[model samples]
Target: MSKLAWLNGLPLEEAKAEFLRCCGSTRWAEAMARARPFKTDTAVYSEAGWLWSQTSTEDWREAMAHHPRIGDVSKLRERFKASGAWSEQEQKGVQGAGEDVLQGLADGNREYEERFGFIFLICATGKSAQEILEQLRERIKNPPALELRIAAGEQAQITRIRLEKLLTSP
Candidate 1:
């Protein structure tokens, strides 16, 4: 879909404010602000792409603090629901795969957390269990700097999806 129309009607200030709330780290906040006036949805996503590229490992870790471990995602969903940022539909979208996949995510999550002290962060919307698993497996051996970059990229994807939802709202 064209994000151009969505951009035109967006309350830029309000949208930025909400984006800031969802993602509060300084660089991410700045990137969202700077990404306004996107000519297309793809362009907006491009900003996310850039944000991940430019982010430092420290900043990525800071951003990850906003999310929970992958397997523990249910609690994150509950938190989002309670905060009114998530509806049933959105929650379901986040949980886009099977329990077995979640179980794998949990195992991966545990190993990752043990290795890194932070949750395994990925942008789960629209991804299948196998796809996510592949990523998780590949990411397991990433060096700290590389993993942070990859994780931040995934976070940026999630941020963009959530931001798009705001534009689609009444």
Candidate 2:
């Protein structure tokens, strides 16, 4: 998928397939499928955000589960290999961050899940562990509805990144 895929007049199924290839989720795939025949890349991607807005909280959580926590790189095989893309930036967020902050993040993640029954999702694209931890601490106070919306926005960021990765081979 290149800029050409984003171009208008691509076959409807072809557009839908591209979206699914980027992120293989049922609702999102269908959403992109239904929104097909988009006249511009911005329009297609704009609707992608709208589609995420319509996703159920559970679905969003399922997506978040795909990501590993900061500093825990053992499980994410490919993602870890790609760590070069994120390591320095993410580590800087935790630079000089003591054990207490790490423990607090661990606790916060547990408490947040106990309250919401899902992981606290964030766009870790260029963020360091400390940045993500601090954000988690701040977001813990948010009411459920607000937090869900915030998580949705984060998911949008991740989805957009994945979409770009799928469209661009590097």
Candidate 3:
């Protein structure tokens, strides 16, 4: 059977768990689970985006907490084992990065969290380490309110990608 069919057939709690794996917000997961029996892949994507847009800053922070600091491969492997493999794959550009770039990401992540009260979030699926670091530096300069919205947007992109991955996974 198809993945979407499989998802639609899952128990409510199991469906919520699957959606939670895509995005960490409990509210979003629950909403997606309840909004189940989606008619098409497009419907799933649309609902994910709409639900994300409706989320509060608190919900965004809850989702953001699920991610490890960018380039922190060890933490990804250890602390975030549940989503570690997906994160590591999304951040593949970090692999074999030079020490200076890695250190910059580490330092920038600290500064970002200190400034914005959350981790530096980006859709790292296709971005290189240097590119991600450049974004981090530029985004760090944004005001708190603006940064929060930008982070939420990035999280939305990540959630969409994860949802696609989920539907395509064997």
The candidate that wins on TM-score is 3
Kindly list the per-residue Cα lDDT of model 2 for residues 18-83, writing each as its tens digit. 565444455786678777666666776788778877788777766665555654443445553433
Q: Higher-lDDT candidate among 2 and 3?
A: 3
Write one digit per residue (lDDT tens) for candidate 3, span 7-111. Answer: 999999999989988899999999999998999999999999999888999999999999988998877878876678889999999888899999999999999
Better of 1 and 2 by lDDT: 2
Alpha-carbon lDDT of model 2: 0.66
Q: Candidates 1 and 3: which is better by TM-score?
A: 3
What does the lDDT read for residue 140 in candidate 1? 86
Q: lDDT of each model, Cα atoms only?
A: 0.65, 0.66, 0.92
Name the runs in model 1 displaced over 4 angstroms. Answer: 1-16, 21-24, 30-53, 81-100
Model 3 worst lDDT run, 10 consecutive residues? 74-83
Candidate 2 regions with alpha-carbon error over 4 angstroms: 1-25, 34-40, 78-101
When 2 and 3 are scored with TM-score, the better candidate is: 3
> How would the candidate models be sorted by TM-score, starting from the highest?
3, 2, 1
Per-residue lDDT of model 1, residues 89-166, tens digit only: 333443656777877877887888888777777775666656767788889899977786677777776667666675
